[model samples]
Target chain A: MAFYDSLFDSLGLREWCGAGDKGGPMTMAELLAKSKGTTATEETSALTLPFPSLDNLHAACEAIPRTRDMTSGVENFFLSIKSSLQFVLDPLTQPLSWLLDGSIWLFIAMPWWLLIGITLVAVYWITRSRASTILVAVTWLFLAFIDHYDYAVQTMAIIFICTGLSVLFGVPIGIAMSKNDRLQKAVIPVLDMLQTLPSFVYLIPLIFLFSVTESKLYGIAIILYAIVPVIRLTDLGIRLVDQDIIEAANAFGMTARQKLLSVELPLALPNIMAGVNQTIMMSLAMVVIASLVSAPGLGVLVLRGINNLELGVGLVSGFCIVILAILLDRVSKATLARVDVSQDS
Target chain B: MTANVKVSIKNLYKIFGPAPESVLEHAKNGVDKASLLDQHGHVLGLKDINIDMKDGEITVIMGLSGSGKSTLIRHFNRLIEPTDGQILIDGVDVMTLSADDLRKMRQADMSMVFQKFALLPHKTVLENAGTALRVRGFKAEEADVEARKWLDRVGLAGFEDHYPHQLSGGMQQRVGIARALTSNSAVMLMDEAFSALDPLIRTDMQDLLLELQKELHKTIIFISHDLDEALKLADHLVILKDGEVIQQGEPQNILLNPSDPYIEDFVSDINRSRVLRVRSVMQPLKEAASSTAGNVDYNDTLEDVISHSDGDTTKVYLVMHEGEPVGTLCMKDLVRALVPRVPSEESIRS
Candidate 1:
């Protein structure tokens, strides 16, 4: 003990670490260390597992292989490929971001009552049910009364853009996948990984790749998270097209393009619509996570409340989101159900 | 049956497998389906098929399932490309035609009716009927008009707006027939077209097809597993077994003399009197065989001739064709021809 103290004193590490002054609650590890013998255990614990510092991980990192890193070689590989990825992704995806930005601006600029009225009208058109339309109207009016009307509109805009883009890009990819076996086999694993990933994990890489200020960051994150369903369902819908119908189309000497547009697509529309419904729901669920990347929506208010530990703000915003989710779900579910009835029910 | 062949499928062979081209030589050298499948992992879909479908005649290809009858018909449109074949529709070699020409030929000269009433479920009955014309790039108005005319003719005038699922099986098939008709093609391929309907409905469909064929004289290639259906409708009958043509000729001739044992077995269960025509039993002109009591038309069924005779064994009637005495038929000969020609038990035992 004297030698250790002299060594600490000689090194002048006592001033830096504050010798013999333990802090905070004892972890199970620390308790066991204390039980081992208070003086010996603490000194040994201090030397071996001292309270965390900025370079704590680095201290023992040499014992672990770089190849077996916490952040994988795959992660590094993706980072390395970022420039090439952006080369293909940027200008091509610029139009999408612009469209989303335009929609967001439009929604924000519109009067709150007008957006609510449009929502009511849309719900009525889809369901043709008075009860459902009135419910949708009340929900919107409630959101407006709470002064979260603009926030709701922003959320709606993002959902619209993400869901629209998902269907637009996803359907064609699904069709191409169905048409070629080799491509389907190659793409399915990527889709599986995308879907099985935790929602927050998607935001991480997207955040690093694109700046937080860019709308494309959240837009891309939401799309990646929500796109799987539409692609799968479209592929399934087309594949589920009756073999006899396909044969009949072939017998009619219809062109490949004609067959797809006239027969296959019309037949697949109901399934594709159902896919869109799922995509929309997912986009809405992703809103809270998306708020972390500076997405302007009700999710932003929810995040703010959490950051500042304001219970009232968090609970109210969260309630508004729930109401929005329910209203959107009902309208879309009814619409999808109506489509299914026309097909085979 | 006529000399003017509308569609001639010549030397057709369809080998079905991953590597059919490699096994073509072995198949052409008389390798059977089973042996080819066992030895080479290839199954023969159609083996050296040859058929000349006559213009304005109902040519029915009769076979049980796996007989390549459907496969053979599909080859006419090249829907299932034959491993080796020549499909000549009119004087033009169909195999030699480019894709555009083939599409043109399909639009202009040929149409098909499927077994399952393969009407587009989303399309209304009228729109479904008009699909062929629309595919051929006709304006909607003109196509609708053409479709309306055919739909009326097929007894579906009142159900124009009904979807396929709303229609009965018979009505759906009528729509299928109408769709084929509206294409205004000279050749119609009906692949077991009425097989999916109920028995009564099937008979009605068959009668409708016959009535339409008589008036329009469209060259119809009908496929069926039922020998009765084949005999009832076929002017020329083609029988197939295990992807090869067993026999093909005039339907009456096929009933009278099935060359193969498989065919004999098929014919054994048939009721002969309804199927045998007067021309089949008629003899060369004999004054003794001629009768003034009634003149039987050459194409009349033997049952009709028998009814006219009223079981008078002495009655000998002149067989008339287009107001000309083509032959004479005696009651005895007619009775003898009507007898069921069941193969003896000894032959089966052997």
Candidate 2:
């Protein structure tokens, strides 16, 4: 019935193979116990199994594991650990929900004019460039004229909180990695995987772990997708500082904390700021994908358009997201240019 | 003279490798640097280095690149720990000090100037100069006042608010010197502090250092590759080769009577007439020489005496220390001193 049935019989494996007998599935333990008695007799052929013959063996023996069984086993293991994993992570991640909810409420509840005025002033103060401030103001007004103001504000609130959390946690991890070679060697591969993995894959696990109603369900997905660049750039920035200057800091008898705060951090700021700009852009990208999990904002409209075949809704929402991205990117880059002293002669 | 010893390095050995302690015996047993590296995969950084630096004098360590002169100076501040050695600074064993005490010593007792002028790029000149004081927890205003005084003294009065990158190489190094001075440390370690400057600026900095030394009287350890700079600045000169001290003493004594062929080769091409002072060449006299041409200061170079005598080989001049005659110099001895001693024929063949 199977390609491997006769070959297995010639090898004196017939008894273990469940040959010519239809049977239900059996556990791997019972299969191993039956196979342990297999021996080559005088009439048995001394032949090896060919490559990729495991599927044929599964067809011949009902006791052998099928590919689907292997996948199910993995799923079962994950399910076994899910409750314990949730028990530990739920407490640690609870505050992220509070931060996300609070910011979204505040951004939407503010008077429209007040929000616009305050945002423009903040951008102007950060960049000290009139061109960047004007770009942000115009982008916001266009979105408001099209009735996309509330959605844009919600997206901005998410990006702000996610980027802030990324920096708050990412910088210290990067600093610790820079100071220790062992820690750096261990962390670099993990960061590489996080950066290269498809952004949608981050949401798959978080969705299973947290309820879709909680803000942290999408918050965790966005933070995980966005945090990689800040960590990598912060580590690289500290490593790139001039060795001569580090020696001078040591020569001044600076304590470890003092050297890091006064010398290393100031020198590494421009690189970290560049990383922050990238993080903000990444957070906006992930927020759209996270709208599949009921995340509020422009992404929700984009999802609605896609699901319902509303070309105008999807196209306009996509255009609005692009506008928000450009505004954030330009403002942050202008601020970085101001902070980078080496750009001057 | 022994009581005046400010810093003493005794039997120091530095082997650089993964397992330096495992190969320490090989380095200690007089193994050559090359063989040690080839046999045990270790670099011999320094070997049995011993030198006593005196207080209120500049000890210039001169060597070619890779001679470990830079490595040697860092040991004083414990920046690079010696594999095996005892360093005594102000009569305290530097190796025995705790982390806190060592930081205190570095902050209050010793300061350094780097060859690359390692000023912070973001900070203004005033802030860079005051870094040492600020690190020691001095108030920002207090540190600024101290930093400003030294910056003014170094002729950087109006450039306090300018960033380091905005200054020239020489001016940045002046900020480095001002930083060291602001700390008011008793000992200064200058690692090729003028090597990065232009030739003209280098000369000006040398003169500035000598002038400052007259008033400060700090025990300074200077590292340089230039023999002319060494002869000009060093009260005690130490020459190194292959990370071992070849000869060290008064610069004039080392030049006049070089004991090794390496030392002989190093001093042969120097402008002897300009660098050799009258005090080193003159014959001491209890009374004034008869028929002396005129008076010459003991510190005058042979070039000065040559111009003063107008190339008169027969005329003799009394060497004056302060106002009294201490010795006499003749043009014949001056001419003889101008020629470097020929190396032994056997030394050349080897």
Name the candidate that leads on lDDT: 2
At residue B62, candidate 2 shows an lDDT of: 98
User: What C-alpha root-mean-square deviation, in Å, does candidate 2 show against the real structure?
Assistant: 4.9
Candidate 1 pairs with clashing backbones = none
Question: lDDT per residue, candidate 1, A268-322, as tens digits?
Answer: 8888888888888899989778999888899999998999999999999999999
Residue-wise C-alpha lDDT for candidate 2, range A28-137, written one tens digit per residue = 64467568874322232345443444445676565566665787788888788889999999999999999999999999999999999999999999999999999999
Query: With candidate 1 superimposed using the best TM-score fit, by how many Å does residue B102's alpha carbon deviate from the native?
Result: 2.0
Where model 2 places Cα greater than 4 Å from the true spot, the runs are A19-54, A342-345, B343-350
Cα RMSDs of all predictions?
Answer: 7.3, 4.9
TM-score of candidate 1 to 2 decimals: 0.87
Chain A accuracy of model 1 expressed as TM-score: 0.77
| Most accurate candidate by TM-score | 2
TM-score of chain B of each: 0.94, 0.97
Which docking category, incorrect, acceptable, medium or high, applies to candidate 2? Answer: medium
